[model samples]
Target: MASNRPAPESPYTTAVFSEDGAERSVGEWNPTAETVRPVRGRHRHRVMKQRGGFARSSTVLGVGVIAAVGAGGIATAQNKPAIAISLPDVDSLPGVGAFMSEDAADGAEADRERTAEYETMGLAAQEAQPTAAEALRSRILEQAEDQQAGAAEAARAAAERDAAEKAAAAAEKAEKEAEAKAEAEREAERKAKEKAKAEAKERAEQKAKEKAAAEAEAKRAAQLAGSYALPTSSYTITATYGQSGSMWSSGQHTGLDFAAPAGTPVKAVGGGTVKSAGWSGSYGYRIVLQLSDGTEVSYAHLSSMTVGAGQQVSTGETIGRVGSTGNSSGDHLHLEVMTPGGSAMDPMAWLRSKNLNP
Candidate 1:
């Protein structure tokens, strides 16, 4: 049975435990109090040394526990205080006494309460802050997104630049092709014009040659006309050579006669020198011309003689005027041809040989 009486105050009180684990205090005689002197020497020194060692060890253990909590090594229990650890009673050992009292128990309880509150606050702070792994992952994701956006922009710009370059090249090619086509067209036109000019020149040269040939032919014909001419113009043959007629001095007509009006001009039959020009017995006026071939041509019936003896005359030159001056009944010209020996021949035949029509 335990007594309920209050224990007496004693500085040397020691703690003892019963079989039931109940605590009790035992009192002892205090000789130091009876002596009435201050405590000194080794006894005080031993007690103070023991107290300092205990305080230092306890402070180190507390700091270690706080550091563990801050480093996230311990899970703080929020709903309870820490379990109290009681020191062993050492009253039976020499120079040792009760290590814990009622006051010490109270202080231990307060310390436990404070430790619980601190743990609770530390856990709350841990919950409020982000973890290291979570922060690192967020930073990595943000950087990756930024890099991806930058790469996409660079690719878009490259594509646009390539497209623009290709478009410019295509336009340049088209321009070159157009210029080449225009040049070819101009060349073809130039060739066509050159061909046309050549053809026109050829045609003009051909026409000039034709005109020159025609003029040359006309000039030759005029030269031929200058070399020959008709003996007389507008005359009619009245009597032929060797014709039977009664108005002849001979038995037959032996000369040609041209009937014309009076005063008709008579031209030289060919180029010659005049041999005679005078009036005769039965002829009113007469003229004779000797040719270069020694042939004599006589005009027996003429009204007047314009040429004198030994005068030079050309073919178709006026040598006498026509009239019936010899033994003729009307105005007519009797033309006779004679050899160099003075033999009579047909004058019409002689005129035909000279390329002339009588």
Candidate 2:
């Protein structure tokens, strides 16, 4: 009987025996018509189909790897975040589903899901990048602030300069005013001094004129005193010429009468030569004098005569003494004046004309 158990497995050998008893290593084995097997049936067909599907799945995976690498390079060149591309599940590829086992299909589907999650993460990173417009706005704000500060500084400088100029102008004006005031004061002082000098000079000239006039008057008085003298001292005129009186021999008095004490001295009336000195019938001792102008003066009724006829006598010389020696009632002297024509004139008037008021 044949054992019901399964046959033992053949061991692996590298040798084969030939029918003529010749041995040969498997490495030198060659297929002949009798040894070559022909495969057939549905099992063979299934194996061929599996090989084709595997080749198609491998090609699809290579295409997906190339696409992912190209996208990563582009993202790097643009300075953007890395991006992930989700590959399609290998079991879903054409002809690949037939070759893959149930477990392989499930793993490929999980890898696809993971790739999509990474792609979402890359999109979020790209959204966070700063834009060109935001950077430009920040730079514009900084420039505006700088310009505002510069404008403020310029305004402050301008104000200070204006203030300094105004101050200088004011100072100059004040200086000019002070100079004008000083000049005016000096002019006033000069004018006042000039006026005072003029006044002083006028006063001095007036005083000189008055002094000259006084000196001239004094000289005139001296000349008149020298040329004439009073006839007698201490005498009073008792009668005048052309008067009516009982003591006069003529109807009207022809001479002036000077009444005095008995011994009063008589003087020459003016400077002249003595014409006559003697006693007459009606006239007591008397003297007659002849002046330079041919006029004659007579002193009568004297007690005694000191000058005689033809004797030269000067003014103010004692000629006689008073007495009642002529037709007189008392001790007196008669004074007579006779012009060059022998006409009798009033002696008192004649004496006054000679600047001698007696």
Candidate 3:
């Protein structure tokens, strides 16, 4: 195509648009057809490798889009909004773009196509690594779940075992307590039995002692019966011992009197030796008999004495004759039993001890 611009001038100038949206000339020069051409894929262009002095360069910029009007120029002033501009593509430069032949352009386009394919392959490799990481994380989560389940089961088993051991210990303690209680009861029963047996034996021994004492008393009574006898028969008792009356000298009678005829025979009461046959002051005629057991019987108011002094006489032998003698109110035998110490006894109680009821 032929150029519309006329010619070049000495001082170079360019055209620009103003703030009022008008076009005007700022400088004058025509870039001939050799120096300019249509833009070829301007946004996608890259810088080529340097050859000779002709180096072509391109760059990507993140700026606002330049909107255009009728003329293709940019302009701005201070404090004014910036206007748009459009660039004209050139085919040749004095030292650049001249070495870029059609063959080299084709080769550059092939290299760009191969580089895009290689970037796509690298993207696939990066995506595969994250997928494997996610799978490994899943495997770790599954193992953690299994371990938790196992731990829960083990804890439950241990709890059951501990409870069982505690139950067994409690049972053993209870068993021992029961046995101890039973043993204590048995011991109490044994002591009670022993105490009862001892009490029974004591009662038996007491009864035996009582029986022996009774038997000994009976034997003594039998011996007294065999050894002693009553003095006289066919006589009336008068003037008993401890009788009070002024019959003669002593106010109280000291002997038992057997009333009989004046010549009645007085017999010896028991086996005895004659202690005396004499005439006493109050008794008149008297005889004192001494028994083998040291007891003395005196017969007073005897009319006559048949057994002399120191005569050994048997039971019922004639010892004297009854008579009304000195201090006697009548013919009666006055008999007295005396202890060896000369203390007078109740002759009635004394005869009973000898098994003589009278």
Candidate 4:
């Protein structure tokens, strides 16, 4: 809307309009009249900064200059709507209006107003955006979460590795223990086997010793049963058994006599022990042999006794030498046989029974 007011008289004049109201005056501005739209507030520089009004003004001015130049040469004599431009206290310039049509001029004014409105809306939209601090804080929180996640992953991996190592160590220890136990068992078994074998061998040795002793005893008994020997090597019968003579202690001769050289070896009749060997009253130095079966034989008138009391003699083993020393007429051995009861027996019969010709 346009207004009219009566002013005091001065040399300066302001914008004026004609009655049809399409033509108006803008002073010493671009021919498009767009410069006037920037007069929005007292804080004009601040408003221009917020809205980017200067940049829009420059773009609009450039387009206006180009359009005016193109239309300048084509200005026909046609009567277009009038647009007036002026300086203060000066008359309006109508010549500049010849280059642009009324429609173009009006469209330029509308575009300028729409552009300002659009710039205002753009500023409001910019104010609605998030501030820089809020964006920075969100980025920082996101980065912190990423770092925490990475640390958790690393810790989990470390824990898993530790558990694996422990498990492996436990398994190895168990295996070693098992091996040691098995080795101990094997050693015990080997020792047991060795002990048993040693015991068996010892038992076998003892049995062998007992068997050998029994066999030796049997052989000794056999030899004693089959073997007997004459008392001297060579001799002649001097006194017959049962002969009546004062030489006998009994009423008859008590023994048989063999006359032989002095110092003749007297042999045992069988395997026996010498029961006595020494001097007697009438028998001189005598040796009495007791057989294994408890028979006793005596060799009297010995020059020297070869065996001692309790000495063992086999068959044909020398017991004494033949000589006459007491109650003897010459060098002779008086051989006598007796029973276990100390009574004399027939020496001839006894010698004959033992397979002796003497």
Candidate 5:
């Protein structure tokens, strides 16, 4: 009868091998077929023909045990992992598919863990993006403000320089103008001083000329007294020419008088040609003399004569004698000086005219 459920695993049909032992079969079977021998340090697979219960059972058990061991090893390795591992060369083994599968599973687990870590890092980076953007914007704004401040400072400095230059220019111009004004004032003062000095000199010279002319006119208008010589022996005047007298030709004495006894030589007062040297009627033995400037002198009552009419005579030369000649007067000589215009003046006063005051 055919069973409905699968057949139970048979121990006699299962394969069995050893790590360091000889190859052996666990169960008995027909020895009529050829058996393939495993190499040294190797394992073999078994094929199922009619009943596959042994093969299936062994495969299941191998997978379950490997899974459990790998899980336990991963848990233990989290704290203390193996330092060195000696894995069997799977390429040398004929039936190592199960071991290869186990290694692939470990690789898959590591890849899953790495992917989870990267995902966590990405989430953290995404959360910090706004702060980084704000920092960059702040840096840009600060740089812009700094540039604006620098430009403002430069502008202010330029304006200050221009103002300073303008002030300096004004100061220079004012200084020049002040100097020019000072120079002009000095020139004006110098010219004014020169003009004042010139005017003073001119006034001084004009005053000197006027004073000299006035003094000359004063000398010209002065009165004169008659000139005479000492022409007698012990003869002295009893009265002057202007004295009031009893022997009068006028109310005053008309002529000078010399009271002498006899003849005395009379001299000419100035050099001239004699106009007359002879006697006259009232003036006895008188001589009339004319000078170079047309003035005449009279000698009255002469004792003798040494010069003739028209005879040239020198000054201080004797011309006649002094005696009582005319009008019963004593011996005398009358000397006179006259202007060309017939004006007579007193000889005594005229002799004092030249500041000699003789």
Candidate 6:
């Protein structure tokens, strides 16, 4: 038979057992049935309370048990906290350490990348410069502008010089032309004056020649008018040829004398040629006449003879005028007739043939 007794409490769960190979509870044990009891505490306590009639141990023994429990709690606290330290869940603590180390390396690599980027930017700034293309374009444009200005100035100066030269040439040409024209006009005027002078000289010479011819004709007409006039009406024969006289260049009278008035007109006894008619010695203003038949007549002692030698006379024309001249005793005409050889002849007889008595 089994007495109904309470089963002891087990200090360890593994120490508890069941009949069917399954874990059982503390109440399953019975003393009267001879079932074993589970022990309560593995550590002993000296200072303990009496359960039925057993004596409790000393306090010192209880203190030894408490000391052992306290040692175990300290050892557990050293191992880990009761709550366990929170971290990334992993199989190995060394692997966690390695992960942290890898994170540090990544941060270092990022720093290095940032530093390199900054250095590269600095290098690019140093290498950069202005573009040659833009600078060259600026220089070329400036030079081109300067050249254009220079060329324009040169062109203007050249134009002005050319215009001045053209003007000078034109002026010179005009001056030369004017001089030529003036010279031509002067030459023309000089030739005209010379021609006029020559024409005037020719007209003057013609007038002089005509005037000389007219004077010669007038003299001839006057001689012809005097030739036909009659002699004086009467006269006295004072001296005869071959008669002796006191006033004579010859030993005797060589001519007859007809006494008349001082200004009586002398006439020709017959038609004859006046061989000599002018002044002579001992017979002033005398005239000598020659007949066609070779008879000679002498008339002297006259105031003047109207006819010259080589002049023809008519019958009874005045030969001379009676005057007292050149050894004449009185105013009278001396007349005589002679042969061809100058021998004196009687003039009274020659006068009777013309119906005139001397």
lDDT per model vs. reference: 0.69, 0.72, 0.67, 0.72, 0.57, 0.60
Q: Candidate 5: what lDDT?
A: 0.57
Q: Write the per-residue lDDT of candidate 4 for residues 1-358, one digit (tens) a residue.
A: 4223332234455564455555597553332235434343443345335334433454455455434533442343223442332212101223323323344345446656765565455444334333434576689999999999999999999999999999999999999999999999999999999998998888888888888887887687558646887888779997877899775768788889989999988888888888999999888898989998899998998999878999988888888899988888899999999988888898889989988888
Candidate number with the higher lDDT (2 or 3): 2
RMSD of each candidate? 17.8, 21.4, 20.8, 16.2, 21.3, 32.5
Q: Which parts of model 6 have CA positions greater than 4 angstroms off?
A: 1-194, 197-260, 263-281, 284-299, 302-322, 335-358
Question: Between candidates 3 and 5, which one is better according to TM-score?
Answer: 3
Summarize candidate 5's per-residue lDDT along 116-147 as a digit string, tens digits.
Answer: 45444443443444455557668988999999
Off by over 4 Å in 1: 1-107, 125-136, 210-358
Across 1-358, the per-residue lDDT of candidate 6 in tens digits comes to 4333444444443334445556565443222222312222421121111210021122223333444434444444333322322222221333222222333334435544654564445334323212333456578888998898889899989999999999999999999999999998998888888888888887778777777777775555454432332246467767776788666667787767778888788877656789988879867778888876677777777887788999988666666677887867787877778888877776666566645555
Runs in model 5 lying further than 4 Å from the true structure: 1-120, 222-358
| Candidate order by decreasing TM-score | 4, 2, 1, 3, 6, 5
What's the CA RMSD of model 6 in angstroms? 32.5
Question: Taking the tens digit of each residue's C-alpha lDDT, what string does model 2 give over 197-293?
Answer: 8888888888888888888865654553358888988889888989996766677899998999998999987777899999975678888899867
TM-score of structure candidate 3: 0.36
Candidate 2: pairs in clash: none
Q: Per-candidate TM vs. native?
A: 0.37, 0.37, 0.36, 0.51, 0.33, 0.35
lDDT of 4 at 32: 27
The local lDDT score (0 to 100) that residue 182 gets in candidate 5 is 98
